[model samples]
Target: MSPRSILFFLTLFVLGITASAQYTEKINSNRPGTSQGAFSVGNNVLQLEGGMGFGKEKHKIFDTKTNVFNFDYTVRYGLLIEQLEIRLNGRFRADGVKQTVGANEEKINRSNFEINTLGAKYLIYDPYKKPKKDTTNYEALKSWKEHYKFRWKTLIPAVSAYVGANFVTSDNPFTFPDDPAFSPIFAVIAQNNWSTDYGGDWAFVTNIIVDKVTTDNPAIGWILTATHTVNDKWAGFIEYQGQKSDFYSDDILRLGGAYLFDQDLQFDANIAFNFKDTPSIFTFSFGASYRFDWHTKDEIIEKPGLEGGVKEGEEQENEEQEGEEGIDGEFDEIEGVENDSLKLEKTPFINTFEDDSFREELEQDLDERRTEERLERERIEQEKIDKKEGKKFKKEEARRLKREAKEAREAEKAAIKAEKEKQKMIEDIDAELDKMEKEQGVDGELDDIDKQLQELERMENELNQEEKEEQKAEEKKAEEKKEIQEEDVDAEYEKYQLQQERAKKEEAKRRKKEEKRRLKEEKKRKKEEEKRKSQEKKEDNENLDIDKELEIIDN
Candidate 1:
């Protein structure tokens, strides 16, 4: 391609690469910037980003001024996996070139596809795929900053690789006369996303691209972009791009911002400019990005909970059903064993005395009857023992459930008492604040104090609501535990008792801390009130003295 055409193609390539490499919950559009994110659009998602722009380029050496209009589009589809995407990027430009050769002016109009490429990108490494384990010190006595210390692992960036082929038709006006019909392009992309203490998230993306390697005039380029999420709906970016080739080389800068219209759509506007007398360029573009999301939620297998921990609601119900079925099966087996013993009792005595001896026959019959009676008695006794054990197990389970229920009730009562105390404290503070406001005539400071009191009440309500929810959760957990195996019941109950004890201790500590804080605040308020009264009295005394002095002077 000619240098101007090369420049235009490179610009389009830069624009097209700006898309995210991975799927995001919110449509991560690469629009309004010129650096590709190292993430994909996610599997089964189709995204389209397009822009139209007008530009002016002035070539000093050729004494030519060109007015350019271009339309660029990128179609990206996540395929097969979350980390892979196939993309089609193309740009068409129509240019009106005006040249002056010593008072001879010439006009040339050229229109064609300046750049077209189809590529597949795959993420090779993702630093954020797995979250780091939290290791911060959360002790009450630790400094607050200790929880937010910087993690060195965050420095690693997600990286991706892209390989694509560039297509150029023969005799295309945008290409050089000797340019090949097809060439290869390759790129390595890296991106880092980090959060600032100011609550804004920042992203930096870098792309190293080698385009048209098979062509006689190959180009190597790099793009660096820094993006900041201003808020939930707005983002801004600044980018720098540099490219070098035998045919064309220049540095370009871009600034842009995007608005998240919704989860799957974005609107953006950007401007790009280059510094060079040989061919100075400026462009402005407005674009929008939208996606057809077909992503499905991935199935997640939860890890097993702690020992003696209850399962989820549905799982717990299933477990309970299974346990009941097992108990029924055991009962059936026991009945089968009893029937087998009865079959033994019904067996006829052996006819070993074949000779017709009445005495021996009578004796045999007696002995057999005695043996049958003894077997029957033993079977009845075994049945009684089994029934007794069953009853004992049932009684134990019932007692455990009842005990847990009682404990839960007691805990609820304690919580309610604490909540009442908190509410009384809030009411007293509100009453005191009202009295102060009435006495002080509703000044700014008093208004601030009232606001603070209202805030405290609001927080108290939230805490009460949380506590109620937690209690409900605990009740549900206890109900689920009723299906625990007979062997595990005692162990689980002991563990739960220990947990309750620990929770009581923690609650006591929390109450003590709260009471201490409240007293400190009350003391501070009283001291401030005393200081204010003293100041008022001193002011009144001074006024009286001044008034007396004035009277004496008049006399």
Candidate 2:
């Protein structure tokens, strides 16, 4: 690849290391230093940052001494998005130059805008935009090392791109004689932020810039900065800036600190120096940053579910309603059948062939027979439905029990594994302490090691306590599940008992009807035997009268 292509790709790589733009509750300012931050001020926020400084420069080649007074300012306004901002940056410089030309000294004065640029920066990549998942339930089970492990994702920084134009008028003292009226400037910015073990936050920002691209003496430079946030209101930073060009080449270092006065304001101070003896430079500066925030709260929109365009909550409610309606309908159908049978049993079945009192007795008997038959059919059908439902309930209960058992086993195994790991770590630490003692004897390092061992022991004790709490929670859950199972069994047993009582009542009614029918049959049999004996006696008397009539006729 050509040098230009390679440079373009390299710029992109460096830009990938920058910080993402995000709206913070407190004003975020790049101050006390000249390096640019990757993030914008925030959408709809206008910020002003400026500084004033004095410096002295001496050039060995020309035997010239110069006194410089400079003021630099940046007016930044977040545009249509949080990730984009437009800024106006300018530096005004006044210089008094004294030169010795062969012992004939001369003094000259020059003043102009050393740098003025209008640019817009847009964030291209943001690694921190995604939220981290919550793992509170399992956090206590994790080892100390695992809990504090470094995340590789943090290595990927947020990146931003900057494009601007430098407007230099004719005969500017700060620019090369061959510089054009308008020159393009392009930059790639990157930043990485992470927390230290000591609870402090660190931010590293990088900027790769190509300035005055249209001019004969184009400059390429880079700025690297490291900032540490000591507390809520105090922060400190160190920066290194390097520039290379046909016109000038120099390296500068700066140290600075900032104090947050309020949510919208900050104060900062910094000192800068260069190592080059040709024109060794030193400067001190103080600055303040303030913002006018006009951002509003973002609106929240909920998307519909994939199936049937229903919302999740509404879909769940509809499912529950349908299930309830199904169960209710089943019960209603059974109750209706039962109510009809009951009314049939209660009403008298009239027997027109019998007397009024006998008809009433007969109706009662018939009604009992019909009621028994209807109830038997109903019981059979009900038992079938109950059996199916019971099977389903049993299957679900078994699956639930199996799942709970599996989870319990896994938890037990995890606890055992954690215990073993803790023991091994303790052993290793002890061995290290013993080896150190043999090698160096007891000293401050040994005491520090001992303190670490104590801290480890304390951590182990906390882990054990957490394990006990987890065990208690599991036991409580199991007890509640058992109670629910017992309640279900009690309900089933009560239903069975009710069914048995109904069967017994029906059987007793059937036996009473059989006894009444037997007595009616016995009374009818006795009446028939008496009638047969009376007819036999009347036939014997008629035969004797016929014999007497025949003897009188013969005489």
Candidate 3:
């Protein structure tokens, strides 16, 4: 093959291999202590996490004390499922090597970076099932209580499991007398975790990783770890890490505790024992890490069915079920009781008072009160009746007085009318008299005129001027008297008009007083009707109270 083609194929092969092993995700599980599973996407979650520690090794190389450090990281995800289970697995490791100390024994500075592991994990089971309580009785007792079991609470179990491939890249330079050029290591790991409760607060986890190294190395080994969560956020772990590489084998036992401040941040401390050496050596470690909780979308909300008060409801249901069973068993016994000489314990048709004497006393008191009330009511009714009779008498007297006054007014009106008629007749007679007198005066004047005419004729016959002048003066005097009489008649008519006006005003005053009396009578009648209705209503209420008293007595 051409070199170019070979290089292209090699690149493709490398790319494929890298693509298969490289984990791309938003969550990093290795940043701090984590539960079993990786954070994933969609219906599943994927998480990548890693951490490394560096410190001086306990070993000395020919009195040239050396320092050692380790680095490790892993990534994984979990598939969502309904059953209380999940898959879990991840890879990680610890590495120890030594670097020469400085010329001064008190101070040593060394730095080594190693990729301990790349792994994945899943959750296996929820360590604890959520607590549940039921509260069916709450509803049945609501009216009797002001406060009730308004909410129910419970906890649910959660679990997960996982498996993954692990690889470690070593950055070791062969500067010493005996050192390796490179250590290519590979591993396969399986892990499981179970959260006892819904919050993943408590958990039991176990993991094992088997390692293989391309180059024979003394450091590579199989690792086993078990962890228990003491609280929602705190965990203690014991781990066994041993190596059975082609060159040598070494084992280390570690006891550690981790506190999760959040999904992304943690603090850890550990005490480790190196068992492979002639005498076991102990080392102490303490570390703090800041992790971005990438699994923020993964929330553990308490299920309603597993809430705190849910057990009460469950208990109530159980009670009801037991009661039903008891009822069925007691049915025959209850039937047999019907034939017993003693009274059958059946539901009472009427509830008897527990303290019959007390009830009797109460009944007697009620009866006495009722009788007193009835007598009082009767007394009031009698008083009302007496008042009504008195009022009626007063009304009759008033009516009689009004009638008398009315009759007097009518009599007065009749008298006034008669007087007016008499006056009118007198006026007519006077008018007739005046007319007759006027006629007579007219006739007399005519006669006088006739005489004057005769005289005029005589004067005319004798040609007498003085006699004609006397006649003209006499006729002027007579016309003046007639005008005076007509003025007198007009004065009498004005006087008659004043008298008629006075009579009409008197009649109006009398009629107004009568109308006022009539209105008063109507108001009194309405008041009497309303009083009657009120008395009837009072009687009805008394009757009802009496009936209730009787019913109580009978009971």
Pairs that collide, model 2: 17-191, 18-158, 18-190, 18-191, 19-191
Q: What TM-score, over all chains together, does every model reach? A: 0.51, 0.50, 0.32
- The regions of model 1 sitting more than 4 angstroms off are 1-24, 132-142, 197-199, 298-555
**Model 1 residue 221 CA deviation in Å:** 0.2
User: Which candidate number has the best lDDT?
Assistant: 1
For each candidate, what is the lDDT?
Answer: 0.70, 0.68, 0.43
Q: After superposition, how far is residue 356 of candidate 2 from its true place, in Å?
A: 71
Candidate 3 similarity to native, TM-score:
0.32
| Model 1 Cα lDDT, one tens digit per residue, 469-537 | 877776666666655635587857765895697589659857965885686578558657865885686
Report the C-alpha lDDT of model 2 over 1-555, residue by residue, as the tens digit: 234434544553443343322123378788887777887877789999998998889998888999989999999998877778999999999999999988699999999999999999998886654322222223322344543455567677779999999998788988898888888999999877665334456777889999988788889998777777777888888777778888988878788899999989999999988777789898888989999988642211111110012223643553474477642343333332211011121221222344545644554455444444445445654766798899999999999999999999999997787667656655755665565456443244445555665675576567657757865775565566566756688755655565576568557755754674565456445545544544554455445444544543443
lDDT of 3 by residue, 72-100 (tens): 44434433432211222333334333334
Please report how far candidate 3 places residue 30 from its true position, in Å: 6.5
Scored by Cα lDDT, where does model 1 land?
0.70
Q: What would the TM-score be for candidate 2 when compared with the true structure?
A: 0.50
Task: For model 2, state the Cα shift of residue 65 in Å.
Answer: 1.1
| lDDT, residue 482, candidate 1 | 53
